[model samples]
Target: DWVTETIVNNGEQYHGLNGDILVWNPVTKRRHELTSMGIRVTKKTLKIQLKMSGQEDFLNLPYHQALLNDEIPLSIGGGIGQSRTYMYLLRTAHLGEVSVTVWPKILKDICAQKNIKVLE
Candidate 1:
């Protein structure tokens, strides 16, 4: 509820899935993503996002089906942490160069746009 509210209220482009804000890296003197966080998806938002990314097939999966069936709460959950931060500090081209995690699609997308790759 609040998550969607904040997203719409902010009126930023592509923020439904990419909600993080960037800070200037004083040492490197470039934009840096210190955090990746935002509201979790509701069923409505989930469908919208899945379609937008052309992964509509995810809807057929059990977890997604449960949400669409209202077997789960309308509210859902955010994250930023050391793994990718280390990649940034090391000035590496890829996060996989430093760490590994299952990773979130939105986060991966943000890093990819920055020319950073993570472990699959």
Candidate 2:
């Protein structure tokens, strides 16, 4: 996890200590952005970010109004890609190798030609 900070767009904000993770695979020479997470923003900072982004109209929305009124608690949140994590841990070259999901026929055929088994 890298310590980072970012201004929120669409009424989201990070109060402090925000970061994202970029996982690298040496064999495939690929990097995947795995997650983005951070602390919730304060009303003051929310207003500032909205003004900066020229999105103050968001304040009219119910969710934004609640945030500005301190109806929501400050908290930390993030997203993670489950299949990507599985690929990294299992050292798989392709996402289909780690998780089962629908794939384009062309993609499946290409992987097949490459002698890559895609688990559907």
Candidate 3:
């Protein structure tokens, strides 16, 4: 995960954390993304989360107050794929063992040539 401290202060944090499985079929040349989601946090929920995370210092701050009152929308996300599970099971390079994405061209080419199957 990546983050910028100032972004959090300005209440402009961009959360890109999410879990999703990508399925690619070489023969069909098709790709699919499957996501499992839960209820997103509301502003009030954020306050609760902040408190839960021991960040209550933000209680009186505008951003913090907004969250406490449920003024902002709720959001939920996380990343997909377990590193060790894929690596051990597929006996492949780290990412290829799981349903990860953005495969390097070289890796893609090698996988294609070897007829390595991807399981989503």
- Lowest-scoring 10 consecutive residues by lDDT in candidate 1? 1-10
Candidate 1 lDDT at 74 equals 57
The whole-model lDDT of each prediction reads 0.67, 0.71, 0.53
lDDT by residue (1-120, candidate 2, tens digit) is 111344567777444564557888864788875555544567777777787778989989998887767787644342236667777788877888877789999999999998888988
lDDT string for model 1 (8-50, tens) is 5567533334457576655456777755665667777888778
Clashing pairs in 1: 40-77
- Give candidate 2 misplaced runs (Cα > 4 Å): 1-18, 38-80
Backbone collision tally, model 2: 0
Model 3 lDDT per residue over 3-114, tens place = 2123455689654344445655343345543343434555555555566668878788986666566686344234442543344344554346466666778877787787
**In lDDT terms, how accurate is model 2?**
0.71
Using TM-score as the measure, name the better of candidate 2 and candidate 3: 2
- Candidate achieving higher lDDT, 2 or 3: 2
Best by TM-score: 2
Off by over 4 Å in 1: 1-19, 24-30, 48-57, 66-81, 101-120
